[model samples]
Target chain A: MSYFSLEYIAMITGFLLIVLGIWAILTYKNLLKIVIGFSLFDTGINIIIVSIAYVKNSTAPIIDSAVSLKDAVNKIADPVPQALVLTSIVIGLGVTALMLAYVLKLYQDKKTLDIESFTDLKW
Target chain B: MLYTISTLILSLIVLVLAVIAIIHKNITVAIIAMGTVGLFTSVIFLLLAAPDVAMTEAAIGSGLTTVIFFYVLNKIKNHDA
Candidate 1:
């Protein structure tokens, strides 16, 4: 079914994941759960970016003995998104790690995971 | 042809796990499920022919991030008691 093409499905899924992640962020009271939601949202965005660069039935953007320069142009999927996502995944890790560090500091001060408990910040 | 179908299905399953990770009441289970979400995302990246992204996701998203969560959670729990 053309309606269920590869990119379409990925696009729909990406959008759905983003919406769900946001909803979770808004609904969850726990700090860790909110971080989980943020991770999901970041991943959804990555998926959408990669899916946008997808080419139907195209091979990966790798040049080998099998593909000559001219033929490779049309046969390989775009490479930009993959490069971008590599950094995105790493940076996502950094941000998540930072968030966890904050969580630890907050819990140390308040000894609680509930978001509603923290309001003072002057240390 | 088959790869496309499989990847789409796997991504959809990831979507489900992601939702669980965010909304589940049990904090530990939800975080574990988030790791699963990352693993599946990597798999989907493989199916899409991006091995670099897939490895990065598996290492960072599935591996490191989950462990950090567990580490912090454990520390928080210990501090509470």
Candidate 2:
């Protein structure tokens, strides 16, 4: 199989990001670093979803006067994933904001950012 | 094909940036690398023909998140200092 087939490349990249993200989350002691890793994982999943919607050489989903509806079916990329990704991206931002706020609160109370130090609430 | 080669190169760059973002010593540097990853991922999304997703990713991932992270970082620095 060709190494750079679009689908294969995208899937591999997305999977690699997921692995790196998991590595960061597992290895890092800092809460902020874990958040960064979570964001990486989110971006990776978004990339994979968008990649699935892609058709090599396909045009954007915008309806145009240049292409008739009859032939447009084969020309445009999928809209569903794009729409879902829109909401997902906004949700990711919100979640990150909440996590950072939590970090702020935790730091205020505990004077530290280490995840290991938070074990008092874990059990 | 040129398209295949470009995709390969872009994905490689993206993966490298992600690793850097994870492993970097400074939190600020790591967050900057994360923003770069987001920007590159949006470009990849555009190349994949998902322009809408590309825009959203750009705005939320690269733009908003980076700003928010830095804002919180500054706040924490001020608090501790």
Candidate 3:
């Protein structure tokens, strides 16, 4: 592969984001920061999915003036991953909201956001 | 050629913002950095020829998500008072 290709750059960035998110999740003691890590992980996954769908010299999947019906097949990027990423984004938002609610409840119960403080079920 | 260079720059900005979001001592600054990451990610999506995805990311990822985070933070602060 080329050293500075579009797909490579995007995919590598996505991978880096995933690594960063994992590091944050593992190292951060605060529940809110862990939630941020999860968000980063979600964004990374979406970027990777989109990068995988990119085709060389292709436009969008839309069939407008830019891309006609006959030539659209080869001239357009994959639409399936784009649709999948859309669903993933909505799901990520829901998951983030749910996590925040859980964090709030935990804080209300113990007045703390530290993961170490919530060791009621720890073995 | 141009696309590659722009993507490289945007990706670098995103990675930097993500690092700031993770390492910043102030939670508010971290949240803002994270939101900016989303905004740039959407721009990258636009460059990738996924305009629909770009719009969704900008509205939901950068706009609504940031608002939600700030709202929760406010609630927590109010509870502390």
Candidate 4:
């Protein structure tokens, strides 16, 4: 496959974002930064899902004047991944919101955002 | 040909923004950079023939998520004062 192909480009970007997110999550001491890492990881996963559904030389899955019904089978990209990513995006949003709320509560309780300071649960 | 080039450049920009968001010390700047990454990812989704996904990402990922982060940050700041 060509290096500049759409799927490859997006997939590589997605994977790199995932790695960056993981690194941030592991190394960042701040609670907010950890949330940012989770956000990046979520975005990367969504990108990968969309890229996997990509079809070479094909338009979107939409059925309009651009794509007739008869030969639409081969002319459009996969719709399944698009649908899946849609749901994933909503779920990610919910997860991010929940994480932030928890972070807020943690900050209120400890008066600090540092992960190292929170050791009540540490064994 | 042009589409491929655009996708290449956009993806590179997104990666750069992602790194910025990761390494930045300020919570506000990191959050904004992450939002920009989402915006660019939405555009990339458009190029990938997924306009619906693109719109959703732009709205929720870039717009709503950033706003939510800022809201929490502001609340924390008020508590500090």
Each prediction's Cα RMSD?
2.2, 1.4, 0.8, 0.8
lDDT of 4 by residue, A1-123 (tens): 668688898999999999999999999999999999999999999999999999998899988899999999989999999999999999999999999999999999999999999999889
> If scored against the real structure, what TM-score would every candidate get?
0.93, 0.95, 0.98, 0.98
- Alpha-carbon deviation at B3 in model 3, angstroms: 1.0
TM-score, predicted candidate 1 vs. hidden true structure: 0.93
Question: B56 in model 1: Cα distance from truth in Å?
Answer: 1.0
Error at A106, model 1, angstroms: 0.6
Model 2: per-residue Cα lDDT at residue A28: 96
lDDT ranking, best first: 4, 3, 2, 1
Candidate 3 Cα misplacement greater than 4 A, ranges = none
lDDT (0 to 1) per candidate = 0.85, 0.88, 0.93, 0.95
Q: Which numbered prediction scores highest in lDDT against the true structure?
A: 4
DockQ of 3: 0.82
Candidate 3 per-residue lDDT, tens place, A9-83, comes to: 999999999999999999999998999999999899999999999998788889988788999988999999999
Per-candidate total of colliding backbone pairs = 0, 0, 0, 0
Q: Each prediction's DockQ?
A: 0.75, 0.82, 0.82, 0.91
Chain A TM-scores for all candidates read 0.93, 0.91, 0.97, 0.97
Query: How would you encode candidate 1's per-residue C-alpha lDDT over B1-81 as one tens digit per residue?
Result: 687688778977998898788767889999999999989988877767677788899999999998999999888878768
- Ten-residue stretch with the least lDDT total in model 4 chain A: A1-10
